[model samples]
Target: MKVLIITGGNIDDDFASSFLKKNHYDEIIAVDGGLAFADRSDLSITYLVGDFDTIDRTILEKYIHRPDICVHQFIPEKDYTDTDIAVKLALSLIKNHHSEENEEKVIHILGGTGSRLDHVLANLQMLKNILDEDVRGIIIDRNNIIEMIRGERVLKREEMTGTYVSLIPVTMELTGITLSGFKYPLENASSHFGESLMVSNELLEEEGRIFIKEGMAWMIISKD
Candidate 1:
């Protein structure tokens, strides 16, 4: 199942509407202040998680007693952030309902980035954990779609979300990096920390290939 987590971050209404209409989601989750956006958008939520600290009380009242929605409330001074809790819940739900025969599970996070640099970085770290569980996790905002990958992946032209595709090393070092069907191709290249070797690349063909032999990197598909 593909689950979507909406966190308490800056989300543009026009962007969110456009994004929602373009993609299909199996489950929707609202985290704390995200509940306000979910309510405003009239999205059918499967799970509501947060401490109700930043969310509007009127919006919280609307879904608290809904039988179809599962609410997971936490204390304001809890150890984990509301977004973290929501991600864990998504993973749990995916595990409980997933089957060997089912297609790959994916978690798409919206409202995950904003002015707060610390929160944005923390949310980015969650993608690595999701990768460890054999699931795909992506963080999406108005300008970018971020994902972490370790092995190899293909980027289809039609599925590209933005005009620019950039790769930033998540690990201290990355080796055996190869790129094909891109404007800037690389063969068995190596990149280290504080390097901008692979940034702002574009696909030259119908599809682009990226293979990383060691270490992880963030594939950011972005727009101006």
Candidate 2:
């Protein structure tokens, strides 16, 4: 099942609307300010959640009484972000809607990658929370699509969504990391934290592969 979560951020409305229209989502969530963005995207929110702090009062009032939307309100003193709670809801839905063997539940987060670095980072870290439950989390923006891959990942050049594929180290060190069909190929390469040698890579052939024996890697696909 594909669950789409929208969070408070300075998102590109046109890009977001286009993305929402193109993809089919099984579940849609609005996290506070995302309620306004969801309204702009012409999408009906299945679950509206958050502390209701950052969203517009008028927008909140408009949807607060809607019968179609399931609203989950929280206090401002809560520890978890709206996106975090939304992820939890999506996971719960997966458990009820899918079979026990359904481990491929994907959560695509939109409108959460904005100028606020702290919030953006927090949203990205939410992927770890999702992964812990054996689910996939992807953060999407106008210029970038980000995901964390701990094991091996295979890709086809033509299947890529952006102009560049960058791998960032999230752990202390990653060993036995091999890159094939890349402009700058590596064989059994090892990297420590804060390494830039693996960034901005392009595929040389039709197929590409990233083999990681240990540690975590965050892959960022970005356009020029």
Query: Against the true structure, whose TM-score is highest?
Result: 1
Q: Give each model's whole-structure lDDT.
A: 0.92, 0.86
Q: Tens-digit lDDT track for model 1 on 142-197? A: 89999999899999999997999999999999999999999999999999778999
Number of the predicted model whose lDDT against the real structure is largest:
1
> What TM-score, computed on C-alpha atoms, does each candidate reach?
0.96, 0.93
Clashing pairs for predicted structure model 1, backbone only: none
Candidate 2 per-residue C-alpha lDDT over 57-123 given as tens digits, one digit per residue, 9 for 90 to 100: 9889988889999999999998888888998999898767845464468889987788789988888
What C-alpha lDDT, on a 0 to 100 scale, does residue 186 get in candidate 1?
97
